[model samples]
Target chain A: MAEDALRILVIDDNRIRASVIEQGLLEAGYSHVTVITDIEALMRCVVEIDPDMIFIDLGNPNRDSLEAAFAVSKAARRPIAMFVDRSDAAAMSAAIDAGVSAYIVDGLRKERVKPILDLAIARFNAFFRLQRELEETRSALAERKIIEKAKGILMQSKGISEQEAYDLLRKQAMRQNRKLAEIAEGLVLAAGLLE
Target chain B: MTGLRHQTQIALGFVPLLDASPLIVAQAKGFALKEGLDLRLLREMSWAALRDRISIGHIDAAHMPAPLPIATTLGLGSLPVELETPIGLATGGNAITVSEELWRHMRDAGAPEVAGDPIACGQALKRVLEACQKQPARPLVFGVVHPFSSHNYELRHWLSAGSIEPDRDVQITILPPPFMVDALEAGRIDGYCVGEPWNSLARKHGSGRIVTTKNRLWPGIIEKVLAMRSGAVDADVTRRLITAITRAAEWCDDVNHREELADLLSQQDYMALPPPCLMPGLTGELMLGDAPPSLEPDFLRFGGSATVPLPSQALWLYAQMLRWQQTSFSPQDAERAAAVYRPNLWCEATGLALPQPFSITTFDDVHFDPGQIQTWLAQYAACVE
Candidate 1:
């Protein structure tokens, strides 16, 4: 099959990550990339698409079903094999570590799948990085709210200004060698206990 | 304590099921610590992920399905990553459960009302399928945990012995254990053969009925093993690890430890179900629908001879692989499969005599001589045909 004509399927439960991968494949000029977010309908979708290559996130539990399909699917013209490039162990390890694995119809030339796999690895890593950043941002925002509450508590109890309360909390955190959030959390807990 | 026995950190991967209790107990109950090993138990979502993680050296060892090492070593499924089993973690935590509707059909076709009889149940299922054949409906779909699992082979063996052609008369698919009950409830599958807690969960939900168990299908059959990448650890570490797990297995097998083991297995990082969900498999007190609970003492064993890595059973699994056409038979391949189960390693670790080779006995009367696998295959094939 021609490189662009190779029908690609991506199975990832995370819609945003799936879309990112789908967009990457589309932008790379692969015309036949299909992204599936619903793993429940995977069996039907796989049969209907008969894609030459499939991409699944390592975190997806439905990867077992895909392996089962590889074991028993009679509809495919060519049996699917878990994509493993023996000559390039580093690439294989990188793909797995990036939380993506590719399966292709048996006998597909490696040169044809390499760019798609590399793109998937890059996209998966980017998605994970984004997810991590989102988590950190969420925690940071929560910490800011707690700090604000702790500052209000200190100002009300100790007859201090908000800036002074913040400084006190920072100084206490430095004295204890802990994060500012930890100091804020301690104050919040102590305030709650006193109440 | 610098040179006086440092702890070795081992990351062991496992799917959350009743059979993974040994590893969990070893970590939770201080068996691993006593042996100078830090066992880190990692819960994997599926067998494929566990296999991949262990294959790529992401995990140091794993609680694996018995047939996995043989299948992977023989290059039947994916890339061959040679795994070795120094000890068997568990045997017989699996059952073939069918939806209540399917169970009714089987009963109508003269299956016993209670579970435990494999052959009669299989025959009744065959009759029910024959009845369904005249209709223009889809084939009855069954689910198993993995392609190379003992569940698949036992399910297939049960069906074929009852004169049902597995691939033709019925369709077999794969589902993770956690999905088995949902699939049955949703009518996406008619039945499933999977390890415990899932089967008992289905029974508890009244969505599925236990038809036959692993002990009944293939008595004393090895199901799961403590597997590691070949040469992953040194001899001292391997021996220490084996001692720890063996002790843990003995603890798991004690009747008094059942409740504690169930609680440990129900932790969020483990099976995560209610302790009661794990009880039936652990205690072998199965409930088939609203009927009285059936007592099967050997439903899931982990102690005594159960912990040994039996090469004969490995060959039996290889024979099943050949019987089902997962891989063709060759003398070298058979040797390779048998070599996956390292009883010698177990012996060296335990300072025990090498156990004599024991022939496997199944529900059927057919002889399972590992030395005469070809002859046994010919006879088994003739019987099934």
Candidate 2:
């Protein structure tokens, strides 16, 4: 938990993600952080560096790394910032949600693990939130485009005003207990049939 | 035609291993259609994903490792889920492959030439490894498909036979079979034990040489089994699926249908390997790097007694689970897991005569009885524990 010279090993396949993690750790005032890309070199690095904490990006979730952690955890049983009691379902769920798969060697200080796990969970949550927002925006844009296309088709086929076409879709949505986006999607799909 | 009845469509998941033959056969040979089932085979990347998908109800059933259902039921790797069994699809199709560099090392170290003989090759490699260990930092890196895999247990068995301590003398790593050849070629691993057509592909690509076949090491071993969620057994659709799979397995075991079987497996729907590349392995042939491939028909066994789920194989797998420190399931747990092997259900589905007397104490060529299996497992533990 010391601010000065806390050793951290950051593993990520993506160079940008690794740099971001390394920068984040550095910015958080941790020193002596190492970023590694090759999963095969993990065991050797674990032996040589003996980092206080290991941070693995969840994007890849390589089986080799997980197996290595299991073997190393069993072999050394060292106290590091990764082990949590299997009985602690809450901690386990939080750890899994954080995109960090970890094993702590026995005898490691609990405080050492908490900070790294806290940081990891925060980063994972941030990434997930950003992803959700991006998806929502993309879906909304797609829905708007579809509704515009449906309005154009209605104007050409049935000679209805844009306002009338919008009212029809809204009426259908209310009648079917579906969202306006769903109604618009159906309209766009139906419009494609004329071609 | 008889009065039309409602047909249930299902999506079954499987990894692209040779042992998944029954599922492939059922779908490919129209057995599923005959049974009023519309079964689609979904190829998955990893066993972990397969288990997760099945547990989440994304897949109706799966052709999984025999130990998987029991392991999941016991919550060894993940959450507990009730698993049911109607039939075991195929048995005993795994082998160990050593990199060309490791093969050369063994050759230079007075290892006897076996040509295509796996046992002899294994013995020779053991001698070379023993001599090589006198030098410091000479750790041999080996790979297995999964920690809970039969390939891992078989590899340990082969290594123990040569008096090699798997953990102390060698580094045993878990690598997916699809990546085994690439890892070997890149010298990331010195050797691997995996299921076919991986071994065959390794040999063909000249990445590695076959050290031993599981059939040679332990004949008639159970490889993959057909498994369903525990609640699935109550469904009429699941019953139909079991019958369809049993019929396909019988057809697959027919020697005359070997070509057709190869064609089915080679299709994009299953293993997706070329017919010629996969045919020899499916037919039980040894595709060696140095010499001509040898025929060993019992290599990829299916149906008959081999397909009958044996309690003894379950016991063997349980012993392996204990040995690997994956679980500490007691004798009661072993018995309960073994009971999940439904031989009678297989009989009902296939309409084949059940093996008379149902020996539970005999160590047949293909399966060891529960008692013999316990003894064998205990002996292995004594040697390696």
Candidate 3:
């Protein structure tokens, strides 16, 4: 993996603490990392950097700040790895809910950041893929339902069997070189228009 | 570290402060180990984070701000997680401090040199704020650890008694306790209401002066509690944890154990601040910035029925929650919130010395009767405007 190719953002108020994680990233050959100390400009930073992933090392973070950070990660849809000094159940769960890949508690040694980053990216990619697949499946189901509805309308309007209506739609799909969903969508649209 | 057999490993959370001494003392002094329990103390920084972590079950339990359990249980905050308090951990650990500049202004406005009744200091602040209203360099900002903290309510009460409007005359910002001293030093904030060591630390570092404390504001107002996920901790585990904590609290309260408690808390893994900062709160003779070591013998208490979870205390928290508009006043919900503090469990765990849950009386002749919480709050709201 070309770890050096990745651009990352490290969020922490303390310059020294941010360096602990920043130092690790640099040693791991990732030079394109930005350390942002001011949280007020966090979302703006995320928008400007367009980084592949984000690392937030918070010694002690408040709910309001974490919520703000969560909003940023959720909007960017970037893989996020977070380091917190202390965690209660709500924070870890909110991290997972926010699609945070690596929600590590306490143990963020300098030698450990690379692997944690990798793990975060992996988890994020996996979760993202799952979300994408789920969306695709849902759309597919909706498309199938519409096609079925268009077929039923044809069968009723043309006095044809269900299979014949489906075959007609399929032939139209082939003849027009459009997708079955597109053809079926056109038919539904036309039916609605005519009615 | 030996002969006792245990059943569960409990991960408890605590914010690093003078009050966390009992829990730290427990672990370091072998009280937890003696109970055959594996106790891991996750030191957190903010009350909000700790509440969230405990709510989500990342931590099994925590040394919680007294009101947090009820707030969490009611699902009032961002995340709704049911929480309960099995025991009160410590009381009288908070102090209010103002930056050196603000303290000087208050003194100039005729506030007493040290520990003037908080109301008198608040009146001094009111006068200074009026004088600053012409130029208005900045609205005098004060920081609290959390909205649901006793620090918040007590500070509000102290300020309001002098007719200092909390939000209008002053700004109350929420910061993690650790940064408060730094913010004061940097002149970003003028004052803060926070627990010991931080107040003492601020004063010690010449950033702020101690104005008043939990001892003076509302004596015996329960400050911190041991909160757990409702039903997450089984009966036997709760019993053993309480036993360990009780022993630890007693050891923490002892005059002999003060140095050892300070020593244990000063380690890098714990508070990590200097031991001398911890001494003032422990010994109860606090130095208010350049002020002399004033004897406030009950500055912070660590042991005894102080740890006993009181239903009445929970009601008091509920009343504050209602006043803040966090939750609407309701008879049924008030009972449900108060139920989070388990007095019966306190009896069952210790098997003796169960003090009745009582009301809190403040220095300004204001008495909190949990039984008449709604009426009191209504009267309080009248007093404010």
Candidate 4:
């Protein structure tokens, strides 16, 4: 914990995530921290700053950050915690699950890598949890909108009460083994065509 | 009728490159429909995702670099999956483009007027880089689409040939194709090697100029292929999928349908670029210069020589993988993987007349042969090991 304040670079296309990671690293007592929103700027910063570790917040399924790590790893060979031995299956899996993409050069001591890696994993997992929750909320709201439109269609088409329409769609979804949202979407499409 | 009654739908992954024409053609032209398939093309952002999805069976097939199947078979991407390429998509569409500043520097360095020659351009560009490296500024940043791509290997080969060490002299980074022109314009990367129409698009955007095409680097090299999981190909569904792809490939080869093809690719669901941006690669008429830009067709090609899945091309790709230490497998692995280049399947699907001799050597201009291959691999393995 005492081999010079761990220099960290937190990169995220999202400004909020970058700020949160930057703040989190600062609160964790790592004084040297830099945050970058542009992916293009990251390579230069990495070479100049030579941070002890890098934490990238990549929400998209693309492997942009991972690809960058390969280049950085090959160029600088920095002893960052990210490029831990691929033979260490447990650490490798944990690192991937934690959403931390990493590369390590030769400068840093081997023993120092584990603790830094552990911290990065924790931070990434926390961010991912928050993101998943946000997505769930949005999807739920969209599904609600679809269900409402489908209920309105049923009310107009069959002259059914609101409660009765809901029951009808629910019964149809269960019978077809389809999600209520899917059945609702179909109902809405059919109604639009008919009208 | 029996096969159609139990038709299987398969999901395929693709990165939006000009070489992905086969998969797109199959989907758009009802080739898959004719064969009783519901083939879905899932556009991915990078080769890494496509490799991962195919490895995990999330995608039944993928449009991948010629090197990918062999690389994966050798467990280069951390997972081993048996893959086969029944149809070659397109070839000779990649090019190297450098920023305006770098281009100007090279022009002053007695860079020859070789027009489309990448090797000459690379040699000239290297001198510019050497002079610029005197100052302790950051290394020149170059971009490539993916690690296992032919563009990546070609860039490395061209750089090394110019006496420039890839990782040492310049920093090569991976930028998605869509972002390459913009990144170059912003001065983030000095140069990039990627497939069209991004190379052509960069010229149009006034961000950079095409230094040389891959056709100049290695003419008629197999660039991309339609890959399917070994398991997926065994199922009845593959016949229909291959049929759809074969028809699409023929449709693409028709010069009269060039505009229609461009229109299809320009949809938001596909390349998402303007039809004009996608036209150059398809029509073989790319504008590489500014003001009065000169037209350079052959920037992209589909069908004809592009469709032949030659074992020699597979061998060349294997050599690249070996050179990069991307795979641990030996030269024997290359021979084994080349077996997956199923020209017979292509004949069946296309109903094209076959040559009397089924096998053809892929070495066009390259000097290396299978015997030389063994010796080269042995020496390479010795150094790396």
Candidate 5:
């Protein structure tokens, strides 16, 4: 996930707060951090900028403003580090639920910025890897089910047992040098079309 | 004099909306002081954020959307931290507002003379949707604060009653309440359903017209509550906090306190809105764009036993959740959902009798029975997409 030039998006309404975050990133040798205070067309700006990471600093957030920032994390898969002056437990839980990597409360030190950014990236990658693995496993299970159904169809179409049908499909996949799932899918589709 | 038995400084979260007044009222007007509590009100911009903050001990409690606690308990969207409401803050402040252009389209299509009529607005909206079909690419977009909010359910209910399917006939998006006005002004969304002073602010900013209030759509249900993480605070602190907020609600409900309430909420620290914008929802003298100011004296009930979260409200919210496929219902889930409303604690804290479910009218003929959530969901499914 290393970009040639890291593009960071700093979302903060306060000029000083934005500067603190921006200066910290800049000091850490990140040259492509964009500070945005205008919330009117936040999504439009995000689409235009397409930052690598997002850091949100809100002076004192209200329900609507927080949603604007939260919507960003929801709409994009980017790692987010959210800083609030003070927050409630529920809001912290919500930030986590919204897929925010770090829900920092009352901490805005410049030296701490790089570590937080690194930590957020690490957590986001770890969690997203687990999710991707879960999805892969589910699809693999689904593929196995389809292959089994195709094998059954083949067994019925041919005067053979299930083991013979499985061997026939394996032989065809090996001979053709194609993925077993691809061949199985074609068979399943053919059977579906036939009946 | 009552004194603190345990803690002194308590941090609470609130949105910058009209109904959030109870928390501000409790903090600013000496209710918290009288109850031996030192309160710090943290203004939050998103309900989810406030819910998260309250759940993780970032803050002790919050002024949250009514169904939030139930959704959280059922693990609807956010992390299922055991959050519950000790007392309700206010009810009936949410309204559906549309862009000025959209309002004109709705009015030309035969909207009602009575701005509060849900059926009339629904019919008008249907006509507008039909007209927009000619330009199918630019479907009229409507915004709701959250997917799990009453605003979403009520807007869907209104649109469904009008035979307008959400995400089909029109695109319903989520924008936090604060952004609704700007989004409408920017032409990102044509309409939105949000709590006060947003509708009032929409009007103030000349971004949208207040078409109808949720009070007209669903009158029985209370809209917001004072939410706290389950076991976040000590039992004594919880009782004292409830007592303080309940007294603040009474102060808010008083006619004599309306002006003071408006002024207090209108302050820069609270809603940061004009007194006029805050007053319409507080005093119910709503100024719908171009239409004459209608007197809806009870537009919002800040005071009274309404703060007591009735079990029926939870059942209704749970059934809506099922209708929208947000959560599945088990027979025992109703008890779990409804228990999010701490009426037992409310009674224990305030010595007040449990309040019964208030009467309400829906856009459809569906009636709700808290005990029969499954049956209700089955009947209500026909009305939802």
Candidate 6:
């Protein structure tokens, strides 16, 4: 069978991560790709799609149900093997570390599935990196707001300029050997408690 | 003192359930710390994921179901890995819970009101299944945690004892423990056999009723084991883990620590359930439906003799695999399966006495002799064949 003719199914609860992999599969010219976000009807969906390969996020709890489904499918003579290339320990570990697992129908050549597995691992890693960066950016913005609030509180209470208030926070942080955010957060919490 | 100088960092994986208390308490209550081990407990969403994580060396060890190591060793489902069970985590926290509607149907079929009677309940279910086959014609569906789980084997044993053939009379599917209550509510599954907080939560939600427990089916049955790669972990580290977890298990089993254990387990990083949800399994004072709290002292046991990894129990689990057609009979494979549970390692680690072989007793009074498994398994030919 042609590689493009292989029907691929992706199951991920995270909608964004699912789309990232879905977009990658489609852009790579895999035409018969189906992404399933709702796993309530997972068994039925798997039967209906009859995908040649299944890419599932390792974090999904429904992965157990999928395992059971594959067991049933194996009984029906269409065995599905969890993607484990014992020879390529590095790739196997990389996929596991990236939280990506795949199941392929038996008789699919190794060379045929390797590219898809690589794509999934790459996509999943990219999505995870994107999520981490977004979280860091949000926390940084929140820290800036807290620091500003602490500066305002110091400027109002001590009758000092904004620069002096900033210096006070920096000095307190340095003296305590803590982060500036910690000092700002302590002041904000203390101010709220006092009120 | 020199051993305490270098702390071993171990990443232990587990599913969030009541039975994971030992691993949690080992870290939480300073037991692991006392052994100079920094235990990091990572909760996996599925057993498959946990097994994969451990396979690729992502995690050092896991709180695993008893039969999982055997199945993995036998290469039943996934790739064969040399997983070893140095210590049994806990025994008998699993319960078979049925939907409230199904419970009503079961009661109408002359099932007893009280719990802990597997034979009576199985007969009642057989009658109910006979009735269901008449009009609705749909087989009752039950969910288990994994294919290679005590929940699956025990549930199959219960159904087959009732003359109700599993997969034919009733469909046994796998559902994560967390999804069981919702599945019961949604009527996606008629019943499930899962570990605690799930069974208790289902009963509390008014969606399911407890029928029989692991202790009821097979008292002192091994449920979860501490599984790790056979030669991957250092022997000293493994021994220290055994000691720490054994101490934690004893603490968890004590009546005085029940409330505290529940509180610790209810924290966000562990089971994260209400303390009340965990109390029943810990105390064994289960509130099955509207009946008064049934006090089955042996409902769930930790530490003590429960910590011993019995090779006979491994054979019994391998027998279930054979009985259920999960794997075929092979003397070499059976040896491999039994070798998965290392009582000698347990003894060397904790200086604990290993339980006698072929000592496993069940509710049905079937004597399983590890010496004569072929002869003993002949009785089940009527079901297995």
| TM-score on alpha carbons, each prediction | 0.92, 0.69, 0.72, 0.69, 0.73, 0.93
Q: Write the per-residue lDDT of candidate 2 for residues B1-385, one digit (tens) a residue.
A: 4512655688888888777878888887788988888888878656754654565565788888788777767756555676766677877788888988888877775544554455466567778776776875558899887776788888876776667778777888878777889988988789988888888888888888886677776666677887777775355676688788877888887889878877877878667777887777778778664657887657878777667776666776776787667777576778777766666666666677665433432111233455665565566567655
Q: Is the docking of candidate 5 incorrect, acceptable, medium or high quality?
A: incorrect
- Among all windows of 10 consecutive residues in model 1 chain B, the one with the lowest summed lDDT is B1-10
> CA lDDT, every prediction?
0.86, 0.71, 0.76, 0.71, 0.73, 0.87
Error of 6 at B128 (Å): 2.0
TM for candidate 3 is 0.72
Best by lDDT: 6
Q: What lDDT tens digits, residue by residue, belong to model 4 across residues B165-275? A: 786789887777888888898888999998888887878777788877776677667788878767565634665576777668778878898889888888887888788
Between candidates 1 and 4, the lDDT winner: 1
Candidate 6 CA-lDDT value: 0.87
| Candidate 6 chain A weakest ten by summed lDDT | A78-87
**Higher-scoring candidate on lDDT, 1 or 5:** 1
Candidate 4 docking quality: incorrect, acceptable, medium or high: incorrect
lDDT for each residue of candidate 5 in B1-385, tens digit (9 for 90 to 100): 4366643889998878888777888888888888789999887666756765665677898887788788877765544567787788777878899998988888899986556677788889899888877876587889887777889899988887788877578877777777788889999899999888788878877778888787677874788888888887888888888888888888888889888888888788877777877777787778664677788645788767568788788778887877766777687777888888877878898887776665444656667766666776666565555
Score residue B171 of candidate 5 by CA lDDT. Answer: 77
Q: Considering the two chains of model 3, state its CAPRI-style docking category.
A: incorrect
The segments of candidate 4 whose C-alpha lies over 4 angstroms from its true place after superposition are A1-68, A71-195, B1-6, B112-114, B133-138, B289-297, B325-329, B351-365, B374-385
Local distance difference test, candidate 4: 0.71
Candidate 3 lDDT over A1-195, as tens digits, reads: 365766677776756556666776687677888888887577677667766556553233644344334433435353323423333334446564433323322233434454645544344445457668999999999999989999999999999999999999999999999999999999999999999
Off by over 4 Å in 5: A1-9, A14-41, A44-53, A58-114, A117-195, B1-7, B204-207, B288-290, B330-335, B357-361, B383-385
lDDT of 2 by residue, A1-195 (tens): 465466777777767557766776777778788988887787777777776666765334354335435544545534232322322445545655555544444455666666666776666666667678999999999988888887777787889999998888888899999988888887778767757
DockQ comparisons of all candidates to the true complex: 0.53, 0.08, 0.13, 0.15, 0.13, 0.65
For residues A1-195, write the lDDT of model 1, one tens digit per residue: 566788999998899999999999989999898889888888888889898888888767787778877666676454444534432566767887898877777777777767788899999999999999999999999999999999999999999999999999999999999999999999999999999
For residues B70-91, could you state the per-residue lDDT of candidate 3 as single tens digits? 8777756434567788888888
Q: What is the lDDT of residue A81 in candidate 3?
A: 32
User: What stretches of model 1 exceed 4 Å from their correct place?
Assistant: A75-87, A152-178, A187-195, B1-5
* Model 3 per-residue lDDT at B103: 89
